[model samples]
Target: MAGALLGALLLLELLGGGDGKNEELRLYHHLFDNYDPERRPVKEPEDTVTVTLKVTLTNLISLNEKEETLTTSVWIGVDWQDYRLNFSKDDFGGIETLRVPSELVWLPEIVLENNIDGQFGVAYDANVLVYEGGYLSWLPPAIYRSSCAVEVTYFPFDWQNCSLVFRSQTYNAGEVEFVFGVDEEGETISNIDIDTEAYTENGEWAIDFCPGLIHHHGGSADDPGGIDVVYTLIIRRKPLFYTINIIVPCVLISGLVLLAYFLPAQAGGQKCTVSINVLLAQTVFLFLIAQKTPETSLSVPMLGRYLIFVMVVATIIVVNCVIVLNLSLRTPTTHAASPRLRHVLLELLPRLLGSRAPPEPPRAASPPRRASSVGLLLRAEELILKKPRSELVFEGQRHRHGPWTAALCQSLGAAAPEVRCCVDAVNFVAESTRDQEASGEEVSDWVRMGKALDNVCFWAALVLFGVGSSLIFLGGYFNQVPELPYPPCM
Candidate 1:
């Protein structure tokens, strides 16, 4: 670029006479000396002047989906005629172009109407090219932020159509009117030209075509008309990022919710804990999506709907957990199992479910103590037991009676206190044995209820989960397209 500029200066110097004066130098000096850049071609406010503008989109800075903003940098070119500065190439020694500052001409107050921030600054002062006749051209580079409508119906796999609109701010249609200049190839309308190699490909979005439109606002020929240029950019989002980060994990957590039914109530109530955890995890994911989306409630996001569906299933699983636990812990003593229910819960269900049946109600041995052991206790304890031992053969005889005779007399006196003590001990042990047997039966009922309740819930939850996930995701999958502008059949 430096070399090119140096060569152009050398050519200019050669064109001028070496004696420091020539017709070419005088003609160049006369053209600008009388020219006023501030003057427009016409003075009337109602008169219209058509200006040709060339815009080439250079960079797509960003397209913020959540914020609904489109940021871009572009190179713009404007062309007009300056009648006062007319000059001929024949007199100027074949000099075809004149380089001058941009202030040397009138500039139309053009602006991007849809700009989000409405900033009025552009890339600083650049040179304009003037023909040997009266033709003038100015080119500048600028960055603009424009507002766009976000449609999140098909989010993560959605398509967006955004526009960059350019219009004259000061001159509506009278003083100045804007038109898209011929493309470099001289077509009436310039194409949305972008340098594809330099474009930054977003990980989340794929760029589609950007098409330009020249729009004319309805007005009579006498009235000033409104004209603007719009470049519509159509892009589609990539779903892989959302799928890997959000969908897969959500599905896994939802599957975990299904596992709650299989988790036995005997698993220390972990089934309920797991269901609660899954519910909470889904809530967290939904919150994250809310922060990244618009606050309007017109429609629910696709993933949000899926999470909500999973949460409902998780809730049902939690409720089922409660019911199963209640049944499992029900005691026969507090709530007697109906005879019919006992057959169904303890007998029929286990067979139908192909599961381990609970052990039958317990029964204690009929006799509290062995007869042989009791006989030995009586014989042996008579000598050893201090309290039950008799000290007399007669009322006052302590050491005279033999052991056989002492046992015979004790039996003979049925109402004797020693005889009564032996009967009470045997009866006390028998009553304890009956209490234990009843306790065993109650425990057995609890075990039966647990197995039956588990079977019931496992099947119920499996059905609910299958239906919930299928209906929710499938509905979204089928109706993913946005129904706007027109119901797209494509």
Candidate 2:
């Protein structure tokens, strides 16, 4: 008897649950039996349907600077009143909410207006939530690719203001009104809502501000007005990636240009080579920057301008290298050093450049009289005295005085001519030696002038490089992101 009673109670409970489910099915059919999804669920045709739009930012997918597009993932919450879907809860087991297919109800046909790929609607057809008080809410997830104009003036350290515009495609401003959603405290929110728990942070970008604004377009004779909600997402680039990969390398390479000037002028080949390499590196960096930014002629990036400045400096260094090399290889025979050039390069400039002048060549010494010539004369005199009277006879005539008398006259007259010839030979050799020495000294002075010019150029390049680099990069170092993405209305 106890088992039979228990079985009977269980059967009755199952039957009662089945009847409740049947009533719920009857409610679904009753709501959609005469419902026309194409018609707006309003009592009057002129009545405006106010839609409250709220966005839950899920992820910042990517921002393509080259294409000027922003791809994001968000959940669009759209809420409005629908008089046709309303019901009395007491007639259907007190059901307060029902989840029904979104196709069986009227939709606002809201879409992304500034989409780049022409895909405007939500990604999924998700169910609609209907309440007993004729209120409908739809939360659909969408991946939007919206157009965002990029301002690369301070790129890699710049912040961008990108917007996602939403509007009703099938309704005009007179028939639809857009409003921002309210928070739990009933205050209208002006900014995009971030779901911290579900939001995934982007690697290269950081969110700064995301404000939503409602705009009303007034109708004209030919154009119909519409209501739109604009959600502006302001994001700043992380900068770490670009700084490490592009900026740091470029700075280090530009420093090499200064080192090229520091090198001695004798190494003109090496100096020119270094400058050319730096120029090539800047070219490569410019190409890399171009790839990352859009192709626009309105403004050049700060980094690009810096690269161009460095290239210009490098080109100047290369030209200076040619001048230094030409001066180095100059010779007095080929290119004479003028009086003014000599004074500047060898005298005044050398002193200013902290260099010493080339030493003057030593004067050639006068040749000493040969003792052998004197010995030759003395030997001739002795030989004349020893000679017979006949051998010493002059013009075959005997001397009336003595043998020594004739020999003395003969030796004096003949030896005087030989001594004159020896003196003339010595004088000629001395003059030739002095002339060679002077030529050598002139050649050395020209070489000294080349070195002096090199010193002057080195210091000049150093100063110019220092000043140019400081001016170019200082502005970037002090660059700061603005507090607001756009200017506030006056």
On TM-score, the candidate that comes out on top is 2
Give the clashing pairs for model 1.
Answer: 37-104
Instruction: Compare the candidates by lDDT and give the number of the best one.
Output: 2
Return the TM-score for candidate 2, rounded to 2 decimals: 0.77
Model 1 segments more than 4 A misplaced? 1-31, 42-48, 65-67, 80-91, 131-135, 181-191, 338-490
Question: Whole-model lDDT, candidate 2?
Answer: 0.79
Q: Which ten residues in a row have the lowest lDDT in candidate 2?
A: 389-398
Model 1 over residues 412-464: C-alpha lDDT tens digits? 54447765565566767889899888877777677667768777767877787
Q: Write candidate 2's Cα lDDT for 297-355 as tens digits.
A: 98788889888887887898789888877776666568877899888888899888777
Model 1 residue 97 lDDT score: 77
Q: Model-by-model lDDT, in order? A: 0.70, 0.79
lDDT of 1: 0.70
Residue 174 C-alpha lDDT in model 1: 61
Instruction: Kindly report the root-mean-square deviation of model 2 from the true structure over all alpha carbons.
Output: 9.9
